[model samples]
Target: MKVKSFLLTALAASMTFVACDNNDNEMGQLDNTPKSVSINLSNVISTRGAGQAIKDDSKVSLADLQVFFTNGTTLYKGKTVSGTEAVHYFSTKDDFDSRDDRVFHFLPAEVNKVIVVGNNGSKITEATTYADLQKKLAIAEQQDPQKLDLYKEVELTSVEGQDDLGHPLYKANVVLEPRVSRIEIGAFKYNAIAEGTPRKYTSIEVQQVMLNNYFTTADFQVGTASTVSKEEITAASVFGIFEKAAQAGATNPVWYSDVFSADKSADPATKLQVITLGVAAQYEHAYTEGNVRPAYHFFPKDDAIGTTNHPQVLVKLIGTKSDGTKEPLYLATSTFNPAVTADFAKIYVMNFEFDDEDLDNPQKCVEVTVDVMSWDVVPVTPEF
Candidate 1:
């Protein structure tokens, strides 16, 4: 039977996170008026292998976004107006100005630097140095309220005011880099039901997405957007899946209860199961100069490790036996790689394809494939 699946591919495109007026404002002449600037948020698209780009279909909110302004010595901070908590779904776009906090007051003088923190989980209001900012991020991830979707972005840049006519224009577009990777499992199923049995292979129920040994390494600086060395990407408790039970209103969620049915003759390529690993880190691939691939320190999936197994199991599949006993199916052997981009954000696609006669044997089943990608973060180029 011929089967077609979503092949992960890489595409070339440039993007930025800043939004400013086209007016050629000159900053040489400024009065006592403050500049009116708006905050913009967008994701850096990563280059894939050969598949089309998949949109960030999930919707997120900036309710907890934190803003900071500094001049290397003094610092100013504010919590921007919280727009729709979970308004719409899209990868990147300018946030709507729906709250009173949308308007910020900045002096017409030379503003040294500006920092924007997306989804601030640590309640970080201010920071003096890069190390301080890193510490704040670590603390936030540890105490992150494992919501349905948990992702964070941080952008930092130095800026001075611009003047068009006599108006002060000081808009600093802070591009946020993703701190975590999103692993989604699609087409998950196994051949278990007997050919003539009354119980047809309808669906496979997933307990939860699990990863044995996972960790995150420091790729770029929060203050300067500079890449760090391996020595910098230390073992600082930056690994593991998001706390499942911590998710609101999720009580024993059967992640994927519905199975996909496809006509092999008509549509040779059909996906049978879809599962999302939620938030996870990609295992490190050897680092290379000028080449950006999300690489973390390799941590073997040691089931009998010093850590607890309350929520570290990557993928758990339970199949029905001929005798009607529901037993958990262990992956005899598997090959899966999570995609990591240049800036450290990721898209891990878990491909599970059942062999033609695997259902007839049921003992040996499935091959897991993983794809990784790299990307560069730039300013957004608006289209007409």
Candidate 2:
């Protein structure tokens, strides 16, 4: 499937901060001069390969926006508001139309840096200093993967014009990026032929799928690269074990996870781990070339092409022979290859194909092809 990139257009209106006095003694002396400033926020979903850009707001929607004003050290506190209350919440796009909904009063001169977080839910609410907020933002909160988008602007430049009320106006164009990557499994195909005859299996039922050696936690801070030392890689929390029960009638199943750094070492004990898929009675159905497959989302990992740290996919299967005899089989992908590097804001489609060799030798790896593209683009029909 081919995907086209989309952009989250800038808010039609800016977040207007009314003049207010600062009383936080930890911030040192701050200029509380009365001034109103307007800040404009916009986001772009990055693209790769080849495709035309389109406008799609739903790709990256903002449930609420939290803005932090810092004087290069402590958070700038307003006279009557501090912590989360000072941030503005937008229940819907229409909320952006109301001036009252965008008002966040603060002393302009007291702020040297601006930090904006969107759709964060309640993970971060109160912080005394910039360092405190950094600590909170460093670790990703457990929530729906789609809602984890961060927008940051180190400095805000003031525009030449003022508002209708003669207050100074500030505007900034910032891009928002998802902290996680997505993996999609397209339709499944069974091409195995009988060992002695041309007859093939009547049906193949997929029981379970598992993703191994993926990162369970991610750092939400923008532009920070993921690095894990040998000692840290052995930590139990460094890798995640995720499994999903494939429903008999469901078209597709999806999983979300955090980013993982690549392990350069070749030591088997210290290298990245692989997971196994177990068969259970959750559900069972025959999957063919037109049936929608499953998908998994995770933090980007740069696993070398031939390294032990490369992530693998395991699938448990039940095959019905021509004579009606059912045989249990296991199919696993050697690795998510071609492009082992999983980056943020990208989508990877893994197509699984099984042949006679795979059916005869269940321990052998299946032939898997991977197709990668940018997220939010319209998907084309898969070539089975």
Candidate 3:
């Protein structure tokens, strides 16, 4: 698979920090005067895709922003030189209109590391160290696919020039990445069934699509390359599956979920747990190539955790019989390639194609093709 890259611009705000007094400094800080330092934040997405570069309308909203400072020996929460508050809140976009409003003040040495977090709420306010903040999990409800939770880490570097006061300056460009992954469902293509099939349907109308056995929470830290053992993965309470109940008179019902995990045994029945995508009724026809649905989002999943059973897509269909009767049919996609793991900031486009087959065998009736793209890029059908 060929991977493509795209740029998602974030808030163009600069943080300014000043120097403070430190007696027990290993680097031998001689300057006691306040010096200005600046830091900028940007977001870049890299994923496997075709040669098309399309832009998406997803914006980065920072309801709450927090900054942390570390110098490998000590950890400190960023605060203004005049105030004791470390966390900043912006209720509207206009709050960041003023240049002084975007500026942050923190005391640090010449060489240090800066960590920035956005929209994390008040979960990590009491966190005293960077390690404690990294272990925190961002829940599904707290995250929005449109307005993502952002995190970035950068090492501060000294700039050649200094401010008007003749104080030395330091700066760094920080790239904040989203903590969730997205999956989009494209148009469906119906194929002709083999001749002389036992059960034949005049037409098939897809009612709903879902993702089964997906994670509901992810760590705030990015690029965590460590893999958990199967026992540890099963013991964690981070997975969920969706279930739908039919209403008495409503044309479409609501979907609910519960904590779920597949059993260790390789049983096909265990793959039925799912979360509905809630596709619109007008775009539910299987034979129509123009009908497309909205994109669904979820957190990253470790491929090594479930060696045999990973996340799968489930499609609900209403098939019409030759005698004017309707029957319900369910089709599920095969397991994802274990080699291709779902990571943060990545977008997956899944196209589901179905043909008439035995209703009892749901997994074998449909063929699915997936195209992976970076977030903020328009999803397109890929050539096989």
Per-model TM-score on C-alpha atoms: 0.42, 0.57, 0.61
- Which of the two candidates, 1 or 3, achieves a greater lDDT against the reference? 3
lDDT of 2: 0.43
Cand. 1 TM to true fold: 0.42
Estimate, for each residue in 1-384, the C-alpha lDDT of model 1 and write its tens digit: 011101112111212223222232354443444333455444423322111222232222233444555545454442222422222222222333344344444422333455555444445534655345553122112111121112333232323453343343444544343443333333343432345444332333344333333332222233112221111111121111223321421454222111222333332122222232111211111212221121111111223212221012233444444455665433321223221222323334443444225433333323334444422211111010
Measured with C-alpha atoms, the lDDT of residue 8 in candidate 3 is 22
* Model 2 Cα lDDT, one tens digit per residue, 102-151: 44554456675566666666545577577765522321232233345555
The Cα local distance difference test for each model comes to: 0.30, 0.43, 0.43
- Selected candidate, larger TM-score, 1 vs 2: 2
Cα deviation at 333, candidate 1, in Å, is 7.7
Tens digits of per-residue lDDT for model 3, 1-384 = 011111121121233333323322346455543233443333322221221222343333445566667665455654555756444444333443333634445455432776777666554556666676665443334233334567876765544445555454556666456665555554554444554554366666655555555554566675332332121111122121112212311343222111222333422222221222222322222212222233344555565423443444555666777697987666655544322355555555555555554344523333334444444432423221
Worst 10 residues of 2 by lDDT: 1-10
Please list the residue runs of candidate 1 whose C-alpha ends up more than 4 Å from where it truly belongs after superposition. Answer: 1-59, 72-74, 77-110, 121-132, 136-171, 175-178, 191-209, 216-328, 332-339, 342-345, 355-367, 370-384
Q: Which structure is stronger by TM-score: 2 or 3?
A: 3
Residue pairs that clash (backbone atoms under 3 angstroms), model 3 = 3-48, 3-49, 242-274
Q: After best superposition, candidate 3 residue 325: deviation in angstroms?
A: 3.8
